[model samples]
Target: MDPIDPVHGTATLLLIAAAAVVVLLFLIIKVKLHAFIALVLISVVTAVAAGIPIADIPTALTTGFGSTLASVALLVGFGVMLGRLLEVTGGAQVLADTLVNRFGEKRAPLALGVAALIFGLPIFFDAGLVVFLPIILTVARRFGGSLLFYALPAAGAFAAMHALVPPHPGPVAAGTLLGGDIGVILLVNLPIALIAWYVGVYRMSKVLGRRFDVGLPSLLFGEENDGTGSSGDTDTKTQAPPTFGLVLGLLMIPLVLIGFNTVLSTLIESGTIAEGNILVDGLILLGNTPVALLITVLAAIALLGTRGGRTLGETQQLLDSSLGPICSIVLITGAGGMFGGVLQISGIGDALTTSLGGLGIPLLLQAFLIATALRVAQGSATVALTTAAGLIASQAADLSNVQIALLVTAIAAGATVLSHVNDSGFWLVSRFFGMDEQTTLKTWTVMETTLGLSAFAVAAALYPLVS
Candidate 1:
């Protein structure tokens, strides 16, 4: 669909965007409306209020909704299936037990977080978190404390990697738009992301975890375990638990495949590998997130699902059950995307960008602020990063490569913060963790802000040195 020009001035668009978000929060938080219905209803109202042509309103709504689902549905489906198999087959238990043994009970959360940082390098946040759900639950259930202790560190680590590092679209797109070397951006930002995660995410999790005693959510894997490593699954109770090595190998499959794709794609972009090679194309297809996850699910069905006297029919049932719990989650997330899409098409982000572009702040600060505004406006971090980078590109022409990379870091930091009602990620964490909207705001939202601020501080301090 073609972009729709704003029929009103910037102020009117901004007001409509703000009013829409307020009404959305009111509907969900106050009126007790189902998030999916509220999001859809508000999306329709917002489209009309923002002056979207009556003929194009449906297209705007479905475009955002469908686009988000296209990325999310398969990942969530395959990921939950993999997680269910791991949970029921005791693969998650094996991994959790090994980590607890090596790291000791006290350091289990840290161990999970460090592992997620590694896995997150090649995986996006939603997929990585979904795949890690069982392990996190297994560990948290064993340790008997707030789930936040175990969940936030791991979740935040993935968020950090996804937002700041390459091979994840946000930073990669920002780096490209700003003419930063991808290799340099990766090398430079990796450590910064780690530091930011440690300071902002890991450290804050301890505080928030202690403060908020969120229990384990039973949404995905059913009832809590009975302390016998069985999550109330009958087949799992009789089957011998999977070996730690086998569990680890199953988890590593996607990581290795996705990493191969990232490396190969980077090489091709750098002209080290020729494009149009049949083998490379095939490998890249295998490495696509959904395809890689699909392959992993199939492998799990063979190795874990049917190995312990469980029939294929039983395995299919297990996978089938996983989808039911996630249907609402999937819909709510898509609707959130729809609302954001309406805002984007209505020119809220464009209005904000135009207004902020001339603000007389320092270039790095301007970059961060613009990205933050766009993120807050439209709820997509990738959109924020790419849009903000393009907006600042001409002004940054005389800067050094290192300076541009630092600017990219700043943009990423801004995009990372302030995820709220409009962001699909906010709902993903809220539903998965079983936290209500307000609770999610207090914990996940706050952690994201601190994480972004920490990253921006690092980038700002380094910007002058590079100059």
Candidate 2:
């Protein structure tokens, strides 16, 4: 039998949910506990408090965690492995160097940001940042300026893409739960996403970078090593880098494949092609995000790893090593889903939204605000987005495809806001850039808020036309 929430009142359940979030924040940031542990603890406590039967609590937790992981874990694992191969094989440097040269020294930050935007398409924010860290450091060392000038643009690009675009967990999960068409969401949001990148990230990074003249760290790129054991190796200094064309082709593979999927599905939907044809089925299969990424990874292993002179054993080792760091990320994301699931089963989202629904706010704005609140409260963008989508999904059923896509963009915008002590991305940026907590708040936090708010503004402005 399915378990039911024991709580009788919506108001009471909402309060319990709020208290659970507070405890979660306290445990993680104030008490210095691990996030995965904290999220699991809160999920269980909140479940019990919401009157979930003792016998069903375990099922509730696992269902949430497993469902999230089912979608997230494979994509993250494959994406990171692909990125690691590129990074280690010098493919990333080739792309970075080519873009910087073409864009000129004065536009170095723009070049890096552009490269990041492309790289960010298939990769998650954290993995993309980690992969790009060495290049960011190398450029800063050569150019002799504050790392922020070089770093923020790239960071913001990844952040923007991750939040707004699909195949990234945040938007994908949000779209899935909201009943938004993934292809339509990707197509409709592309222009807005680019504009958001330019307005929120590209232009703003320069101002913030100049305002905060932070220094580059001494051993920041230590993880990036040459085959000869020297740390912080680059193409120009030692070996022949992979050709820019080759690197670019590799990066474009996933994008093209995924885009093909989007286009083919659209064609099928419009009755341009028979839906059940074998060729159509095969094309769609290849276009699946995870499958596309998997193909890209195998291609990278052969071209980048094997052709680049690494043995099979060495390539295997690199892929294995990449998985270790991401285990924590995967676990925390799953736990966040678990927490969101608990809130869902207890009817907190429905209860809270019903109370807020009477405020007569537009559904677009409502989505953005609810997502923003969840983001600030929980510090996990995927959880905030998925939870917010769940809350508003029923109400949004009558909206058009374009409207649903815009709503997804707004929710993504809200999910991107206010990185602080509670957010893991904040610390990752802080540590990598060698900024103290206060400086991180000033620079990274400010960049994030700007990115979120600008995207929200653009999405809000475009809502009228779509509606």
Candidate 3:
């Protein structure tokens, strides 16, 4: 019986992976450890424990870094830079200002919900946080409530896009890996994600806001947000807020390009456009071309600035600032991909996919359970998303491409569950709310669980109806 063989003993490999989670969690939660350092340790632990040679660790790490970073680095780089600018120039502050002032104390959550839903579509979860956190800081100061109230909404908004939207890297890569139709997948999950945002984000934030007070300890606060005041708000005048139109225009470049590519490709395939026509090819280049976000970021830097009424040099500096926050998340996600890559190359994913598929469990449920397990173990949603996507794509070959896309989103939702000590998000919440780890666990973790279960629940109800 080969240990990695699916039929004979593949469960042992999975069990080993499962056990690694417990060990990793202990290191972080019990030891008061750093996640950046911890994730690297876990990657090595997972590989060797599953029987990979210690000598091959370097190769595995490189492979993971190259593959995951190739897809995410650009988007993340742009996100970081853009978020830094938004933070410095008071773009997010503008949104927070309007919402907090208009809604008042009782309805900050609703404002958060709307803000997250709107802003979440364009950027990754953490990027959105870096960009918009000043707003959360402002709201917390005005209302004297938990940062979780606004943070959860912002988190959910980005989560929805990461899980449901196209070209977001996670689902896009998964969809490609599984031969799924990207457009079909987006259309199917779009409405469902919208509903989940309302119930999972809005209602939960409102409840949590009332129940908990949010912000970080004085020491952590001083370290993370400097000169931002005791409540973490540094802006005094609120002079000129960033223009909504400009901010949104900058965000739309990638979306429009990708969408145009999808549509033009469809038309080309249908023979509606002559093959190889310059006009058709130009349109395709606009959207389908690789490095879409890269190009957009450059354009944004050009368009935004003092000459055009964007705070001079703020956009450039903003992008520069986003990189500081990028280190931990990028490395953490890269490590997860490294483990997943080993599973992919080792045929472990194949074995597990086959073994699980035979159980008659719906792919949706299987996605939920797998994501939940890894998330609880490692406490990284990206890790959960990457691992589940890798494993499920192996099994999903037989599924309709549309179904495959939905599965990607479903896995994302599941991995979203149980964010705690090992998860950076938990700390982000804790820092924002000024709560210790324990209370952060009670609220932030629950908000994440709501996102995970509610997303699955929503997808489950819709699966039958759609299928």
Candidate 4:
């Protein structure tokens, strides 16, 4: 539907801005340009293209950059460090091994799937993949199974949590930005995610199994080498896995604290922060994701460092190495924020949202479609999500809590569709699964598309219920 309103101009401007984002992502990822630099370059391009006054454009850019970085920088940075510590200590593998031992053979895929669901509850998707990949590989080998079986289930489990759960960064970030309840998001999304994963980890994987052969694909990066006990990878030891207490405690601290604070703030009758509840206060403080992750990083440093008899220098080195690749991601995402913020402030989003009015589609579907188009083009789910959220945030006031939760999931699913050469996740999975680029495109990428569309299909199914 077309509208003959002033926002029509704004709508066009935003469509251009959104398209610029995907183009920018494509250039960076497919053209081998660095994402960080590409994002900055694109932000400037968007500013000029939006016809933002020269005087205000720079400020808009700076404000967007600063605000966006402040929102997610700490969580992403600390999360990177935490995942690194976990990986280097063999903690991720140890956990999977322990779980498989407990769950046994008849249902190994189920066991790995469950491991991903639980472990993914507290970590970012990329970080989770890097840490858990080793264990997944090990399990695949142990069960005499195809990599597709274990990897698909594991990916399904992880994807479900990443898309639907809270205290993990995506939903939490969406919640904080929109003033939605982290607790309610967790409560609401748990069932949706569980329901989705039931379809994904179990049924979806099996359904798609014939199309994808298992075992590490030969074309996977460095797959032929096997790189055992390398200095970069986890080293095996006679020692037990990192203490269950340490692992479980690190994972739960953020959830419990964040949940506690959310409840206390929502339910507490007294206006003032109680003076004697220092422990709860502390938990709440620890629960602020960045702080919680920092604490987890500290926990890993202490437990993993001492247990492995690593020196302080070595410990720091491990942490640093873990974060090496993430710096670009954080910065690129920040640039994306700047790009998103500019569109919002420039009144472009308002124009677009208004244009979509009276289209007779559910707002959630609108959100998903816009996000999916961007994702299918660029392959960066983060950009797809941030861009879509920035646009939809314009219409947020009109939505209910259930609707907001659905929108968040919708945005996530949209961002996940059609991983092409441009998406890092494609390459990561491609390399991990040992597919050549084409095969990776054929299988791993298609799986992601399946995930993105199916999640929305379920979300759409639930819309009438919510309405």
- Using lDDT, give the best candidate's number: 1
Candidate order, TM-score descending: 1, 2, 3, 4
TM-score of 1: 0.98
lDDT (C-alpha, whole model) for all candidates = 0.91, 0.75, 0.61, 0.63
lDDT of 4 by residue, 315-392 (tens): 776666655655655565566566656655555644644555447776788888777765654445665676677766
Off by over 4 Å in 3: 1-8, 99-105, 119-144, 165-188, 207-213, 216-329, 336-355, 361-445, 462-467
Q: lDDT tens string, model 3, 205-306? A: 779877876553332123334423322323222346557666666656766666677567655654577788898788778664235566665765565444
List the candidate 2 regions with Cα displacement exceeding 4 Å.
1-8, 116-152, 158-189, 204-239, 269-273, 307-309, 362-364, 370-449, 459-467
Candidates' RMSD to native: 1.1, 5.2, 6.0, 6.5
Model 3 RMSD in angstroms: 6.0
Ranking by lDDT: 1, 2, 4, 3
Tell me the spans in candidate 4 whose CA falls farther than 4 Å from its real position: 1-11, 18-22, 71-73, 104-109, 119-189, 200-280, 361-449, 459-467
- Estimate, for each residue in 28-91, the C-alpha lDDT of model 1 and write its tens digit: 8999999999999999999999999999999999999999999888989999999999988889
TM-score for all predictions?
Answer: 0.98, 0.74, 0.69, 0.67
Per-candidate clashes come to 0, 0, 13, 2
State which candidate has the highest TM-score: 1
Residues 1-467, candidate 2, lDDT per residue (tens digit)?
A: 24374466877876787778678767876787887888789889988898888888999889778877776677768767776666666676666667778999899898888888887776567656765765676666557667798999999998888888976667777887777788888887777878888887788888887788887664333353333323453322244667878877876777777667766765675467887888878888997877887898898888877654567887787678767776766777677667767766666655655666567788888998888766765466777789889888998888888888999999999889887644556656765577765687788888888888888898888889867
